[model samples]
Target: MLTTKLGVLLSGRGVVAGDRVRDALADAGLTMRSAFTLTQLAAGPVNQQTLIDLLGVDPSAVVTVLNELEGRGLVSRQRDPADRRRHIVVMTADGTRTLHTVEEVLDKTDDDLFAALTPRERDQLERLLTKVADADSCAEKY
Candidate 1:
């Protein structure tokens, strides 16, 4: 039963279902998935390579996403003052507002996603998921 459930959860339906959540978020103009780039930028100025590592996306893809965000006046990328060889990306005021909107949407999305779970179960799930995320990074270092 456990194996069957795991297999189903790993199937395309599960993937698409998760995509639907992002789609719904994007439909509102927040674009939560790509906004990870903006959110990372919002943290502080980070170079393109840093975004690539943070988002785990291809270099070309990262450039494309940054281009779109820049075109929208949401972000700015410039030659790092201290490191001419690297470009630093930073969020504008608009980007900060948009990131806040995305956070609100994410809060709603999470509530909807975990609607079936009790508060205690939700806490347990968060702990377990954090552990899994940590393990993934640890695996990458090995």
Candidate 2:
């Protein structure tokens, strides 16, 4: 018997969608973590510690990601004027362009995932999900 549980269904669908998104991002030469980093900097500069905390990863892992992004000219780290010991991460023009590409890729993935839904249904679903996401403080950055 099929269980009628929204949480279970949503979790399963989320995993599938996540995989699809990861694959699409990979084609654009980005990983989820790297794309997230760029997305965070899209708003403005953030100190390295902020990134590390946002990413919830080892400091070294964040450094590796930063190194790769810097090497690609997507981002740069500059010493913060307020605090010389802290390095602020800023997205470059190239990174902005790449972030746009990432958005397009995610949009495509959304379309693919919601292909079964009618336009109206998609809109309704988005509204409902937005409400849920809005309730979560962490969703603001995402």
Each candidate's number of clashing pairs is 0, 0
Candidate 2 lDDT over residue span 2-95, tens digit each: 5568778888998999899999999989998899889878888899999888766789988998999999999999999999999999999999
- Scored against the true structure, residue 67 in model 2 reaches a CA lDDT of 98
How accurate locally is residue 14 in candidate 2, as Cα lDDT from 0 to 100?
88
Off-target runs (Cα >4 Å) in candidate 1 are 2-4, 10-13, 30-32, 137-142
RMSD of each candidate relative to the true structure = 3.5, 3.0
The digit string of per-residue lDDT tens for model 1 on 1-142 reads 7656855665654576577668766865756446777777777888878888888766897888888889888888899888899998888898888888877877777787778899999899789867876877544310
Give model 2's TM-score versus the native structure.
Answer: 0.80
Best by TM-score: 2
Model 2 segments more than 4 A misplaced = 53-58, 130-142
